[model samples]
Target: MKIKFRVILSISIIAVTTLMFVSCASDPDSSGLEYMPDMYRSPAIEPYVDYGEVRGRENKDLKLKRSAMIPPSGTIPYYGTDSATVALMMPYARKANVAMKSTHGMYDAVLTKENEYDFALADKNPLKLTSDNMGDLFDTGKKLFTANCAHCHGAKGNGNGPMVVSGAYVGVPDYANLTNLSDGQIFYSIYYGKGMMGAHNSLLDKREIWTLVHYIRKFQDTDYGTSQSAKALEAN
Candidate 1:
């Protein structure tokens, strides 16, 4: 009788100890026992979010279903009302060299038998600047630069952007050193990426890229395009 009583007592002690440990270790009001609390919650619908489960509950039918797709080739986007802007947005006449197929994955692009990137040196920036619109253009340029270039090219165009400072990427050249690059060549490099950089044509439209060219030129020549705008405003 004493042995059975001792066994029951031992079992009760173990149960009490377990309950106490659990209660002390976790807060019932909080995300109880979750090592990574974010793993248990869905804050928003992300393109890459795995919606298979939420907080230990599994039900695909309850989650938002997303389908991935790419736009078809040769489909032109609406370039808006400006005739000059529309002309500027037309397809680039220059072609990438045959080596681009293996080097830069220009498989989908029309490749050339010879090197044509060199020809881009003759190209000029079509987006002329004047004092009347220079201020607004730089304002637009600043927003575009922050959104696209600042992360990799640094806020000051010194090539020490956060990605470089954090060691996530390397070998980003300073804009000041690239003074010899023609405006058109700069456009080409961004449209069809050069070296390690990927093509940005899909991400940025042609008009936006030209605006960036004007902004980038400011790095090489601090007073670039400003005088033109100032002169135009004064003349007007």
Candidate 2:
């Protein structure tokens, strides 16, 4: 009985030791031989992770499908209950030019054969700058621009951003040189993108884009968005 008990204990120890070895891999990155791998790795779909060849198994259907899908058409996101804000957040009326499908990767966007960028030239910014709000608006614009535009457009809007300096990108036009661009034209370029710049519609809302329009104007004129500038704009 004693010998049998000792043998059972020895077998149990050996089994556990073997399991430890089987579970480990020489490659430090690999977690080998996972027991119930489903429990260890979730089956839930994750955006941007290629699950096409998960765990040495090929899934051709999944391989063909994009993990990150564009939002369905006509889906409006919930923006809170301010009438002005709601109006500001409403879907843009303008459509991308058909050529943008090839030039700007806007294949999924609603496209028109017409020169909509020219049409956008008539679309004035709805976020009217006032002396009371210009301070807050400019502040918000600065933050937004710093996060999204400064990398490529530069902090001073001189087209000498870190990306240009690093030789990663080129042809970022200087705001100082773009005096001919209408406010609406600048907004259109930012919304749909121009040349190498991709569409920012996905990243920024219409209000923010307009705010950026206001901020970018300051790059062209030092007095832009000032109380005096607001009065000057009203006169113009």
On TM-score, the candidate that comes out on top is 2
Per-residue C-alpha lDDT of model 2 across residues 164-227, encoded as one tens digit per residue: 9999999999999997788889999999999999999889989999999989998988888665
What does candidate 1's lDDT look like per residue over 118-216, in tens digits?
Answer: 888888777777667778878888889999989899999999999999999899989999977888889889888888777787789887888898888
Model 2 spans with C-alpha error above 4 angstroms: 60-65, 78-86, 99-105, 128-182, 194-208, 231-236
lDDT of 1 at 233: 37
In candidate 1, position 91 carries an lDDT of: 79
Residue pairs in steric clash, candidate 1?
130-229, 131-229
Where does candidate 1 stray beyond 4 Å?
A: 1-73, 228-236
| lDDT, residue 76, candidate 2 | 88
lDDT score of model 2? 0.88
Error of 2 at 117 (Å): 3.5
